[model samples]
Target chain A: MVQRLDYLKESPSQTAGPYVHIGTNPNWVEITGVWKDDLGLVLVGPETVGERILVEGRIIDGSGALVRDALVEIWQADAAGLHNSPTETRGTADPAFAGWARQPVSDADGLFRFETIRPGRVPFSGGGLQAPHVTVWIVARGINLGLHTRLYFGDEAEANSVDPLLNRIPDPVRRATLVAPRTERDGMPVFTFDIRLQGDGETVFLDM
Target chain B: MSGAYFQRDRDWHPPALTPGYKTSVLRAPRQALLSMPTTPSEETGPVFGHDVLGPLDNDLIRNFAKDGGEAIGQRIVVYGRVLDENARPVAGALVEFWQANAGGRYRHKKESYLAAIDPNFGGCGRAITDAEGRYAFRTVKPGAYPWPNGVNDWRPAHIHFSVFGHAFAQRLITQMYFEGDPMIWQCPIVKTIPDPAAIERLVAALDRHETIPMDSLAYKFDIVLRGRRSTLFENRMEGN
Candidate 1:
């Protein structure tokens, strides 16, 4: 017998509570000296490659109220369809791009924003190209476990049509919830992607 | 071009819509969760350098102290290892923690608890696991407090932990309860979990062996993250 120990079960998740900012982004809450700056504040520098774009959105609850306490994190590939991770076996991702950012929804506006380059099409594990998309993870006081979802570009209609993951959804109406339509703000490309926790037009939460 | 993938065990997690946890009623998704495979985006995560941590980043006792004052409470040392399901060490993982002070009061403006806040306790800390996947920190034993969830629902003393494994998919945010805390059974939030075994995994046992003599008691809590499938299975698929 190998005599290996049994695998340990995962720990139970709990709510992040209203003070999650104190731990994740202390500086945002005015607690200084924890770090020079909070991690994930900047995703791209001036030298980063690809189309510079901005992503903004709010997390709305089932009651149609904005969740001011929610924290949002995003992960995506670089413009060359490469990830800035050691696990990425493809070509090198943009050295200047971190490709990950965490932002807390502003208490005043209940909105979170990220400035980065448009991601390129990444390969689906099942062997086809996926639409250029950004993976989004959300946590808040009411949420016991973090919710997982993705944001697809509405402008990539041609690519979205054949995306393995997006096409898996049988209903086009539900699929539309994952697409963020592009709009211009002061000559800058902006994608507004709002996430609804429940009820009508609920986002397609992913189980990965 | 792809690596081994591990599926999340949804059954182990509490349902999103547990009514007892009042917040879940409105926040849980009504639609069934959609399933997907791991991608570069899911498998990759942000890398945090050690430069981000300061000298007192992991010592909550004096991290926020002013005028050389220490937090008021029973001092404790929390030690543990971050491991994968396969029992492999998950080194370089960032472990962030926060909790109420010894008086059961958080240092936040939104905290409604009437307990007095300790001037020396900020109640938050961070640590990066070593090559052995072990991490330790010193702090005061947090006090249990009441919440507005129910008429008299009181939460057990607990510390919140945020862990980041090598992959974004391995990120986890959870709480660690003290062993023998009867309130763990009474809390509506802890009740949401269907399995008692899973709940037990969240409880840290007192480690007398590791306790500092007359200095601080010790608690041990080992965290487990999702593991990758064996390479042999990937090889078989490639051959097929």
Candidate 2:
């Protein structure tokens, strides 16, 4: 197979702007502070009792087009269903559990792989419930236009059934894009998700 | 890599850091890293596009559709003010802007405005400095364009302002919103003007006889490139 590449002549790494890393948003600012993993974590669901699972995904823009050189940052609650809020979870003294995190850049295939334990269910406004998921942020072309979305356990059909945000996405296929993949691959339980940006197969984002 | 062959200097040399001072800043040596060339091309050719290859569907903001094409070599003036951190007037500074006309366009290929994508309005203009560091452009104002926000929203009629000498790292990229516009609140990047009259002050004040300072309809866009003082960070170990 031939590798697709930019014919700009010079290497992009040589031409890219300096200080491209302005900083991550507050959510991720809180994340890299604490909940981070050096090794890839297997994304486990309610059905699979995974001693080893690797949750991997590629984030695509609104047009379902791959943002080849994008950066995605994510952070979520641990498996215990607790957040790093002084009003909530402990580890307040420790610098790690900031409940925020960051990812520098996406790979050649526009893929970003995050290693983390399964997050627990969280509450939402108006009795609506947020499923156990990971919040994502995107920085592409050096501008940090914060993109907030979540990743949910697909194998957990019962949990997905009650999720308010997923239920409100309008289109079934569009809603399905938000679900994380859970299946056996190469002798390991692996969750594969391809997060889509705007238009079809996408998640919601705030104005901020 | 070819870059590795270049001579390396490990010595650290820096002047005493000072706040609100230009001497200390200009003296600051350029980084070892290659600096991108930002020189504006002085070539002023037949800038307006000519329908030489005939019109195509892929192109927008076609200026060459008519005879002799759109107005090229049109000279205009730019008038605007300068505001400090608290949005106060910083009387003496330099403000310069380079952009295409009302078509929301640019001479450069990499423009982000949608008006450039439109065939109707051709946006292009540039403003130079004045005594008060005020700047103005001699062109029709640009129209608000729609962006693909989660929900569709139109950007307010605005012009970008670039400022210099305010401080190091004071390179600000800001757009001016037309006065009395409702969309200002909805814009994600627009830091709201606390005062209702802020917009009016930013606009050309007709009664103040400051109306139309230079060339065509004047727009007084005072800018503070930097938000006052900020540190020029240098990484070092504890002892150093």
Candidate 3:
């Protein structure tokens, strides 16, 4: 059969290149990028430790098997919407920004946790900062999966209404799914982002 | 922080969002066969070499490759299936395989195959199958190694397979080869491993159905990620 090359162009198989993800480069080892230190992207004169958010998640197989060696990677902007990467320009003062981190292995329970300062307000391409959000990438069993989502402060209702990313979503419940509740810790703010990689509570992703 | 990414202030209300973001996808619980996340960790440690791979090692190219630095094995074909609770082809699933090229060696930089010193057939390759969800590759069996733990172990000649289903959440990672393959029998990964031959309806059927390729034999590997009835484990918690 004569193959229509155009159809082949549309096949996702053509996308067999190494998945471009936020965390974990090549093997699961090494400390690369600006997210290496405690304050990921919070520019608080080095004093504002930013919000404390714990990203607990699992790596279950299609067979529902938890692969222990699986590595979890997360990249997010600080509460100020500024990424730690040199690229992110924050409303807070700091030109040296780097917005990324890599957590090599999940715990024995297939769980992973990250302690980062709240992201600051940074601008998107056409608009202003995206939701105070983080992007997640789960690499286990040699398979690289990409997941992008944002976390909103629990009571940041005013922000949610005008949040560039959230405002685009028309649904209430699904949009609500994107916002992580804000919890308090030692007079500091915290957001618990428990990621469900697959099945029921699998996180919703951005079009990109 | 700029007010751009604002949550509702006392005077503000949640802005109206588009329907697609929240409505494009709905989630349901995955069956058991495909959901193997709740299993436990079983690592007996370093098993290097001693597993037999049918045709992969016999690569006529092997003769021209490095000496002493080699992994050797037989050319045998094994078969199996990956089905839902009702037993169906998980088609389009992806499988990956990694093993020492015999001689219990890896072609990675850490393993010493650096272009600076040497470059060998110790690299890794992957393959995807047809609608049958079946896959095959040409590779040698694996060997075990002695680590700090101090044990006479050999890495299994197992192939690591990662499958992404129709949905992003339906993905799974697993391995398969043979029952008698030394690694399969003694490797730590086999403890929780189910009986390969008796894996219910989705068992991989040896493809006696086709002519064996001469270059390097072939294997019919299939994996069942999810569905109900026959104890399939779908990570319904993640919303597959």
**Pick by DockQ: which candidate is best?**
1
Q: Arrange candidates by TM-score, descending.
A: 1, 3, 2
> How well does each candidate superpose onto the true structure, as a TM-score?
0.96, 0.37, 0.39
Model 1 chain A: which ten-residue window has the lowest total lDDT?
A4-13
lDDT of each: 0.87, 0.40, 0.38
Per-residue lDDT of B122-189 in model 1, one digit per residue for the tens? 88899999999999999999999998889999889999999988888888888899999999999998
Global CA lDDT of candidate 3, please? 0.38
Interface RMSD for candidates 1 onward, in order? 1.9, 25.1, 19.4
- Model 2 regions more than 4 Å off: A1-19, A22-53, A62-64, A87-99, A142-144, A185-188, A206-208, B1-240
Tell me the spans in candidate 3 whose CA falls farther than 4 Å from its real position.
Answer: A1-70, A73-208, B1-82, B109-118, B144-150, B194-214, B228-240
Error of 3 at A66 (Å): 19
TM-score of chain A, model number 1? 0.96
Clashing pairs in 1: none
Report per-candidate DockQ.
0.66, 0.01, 0.04
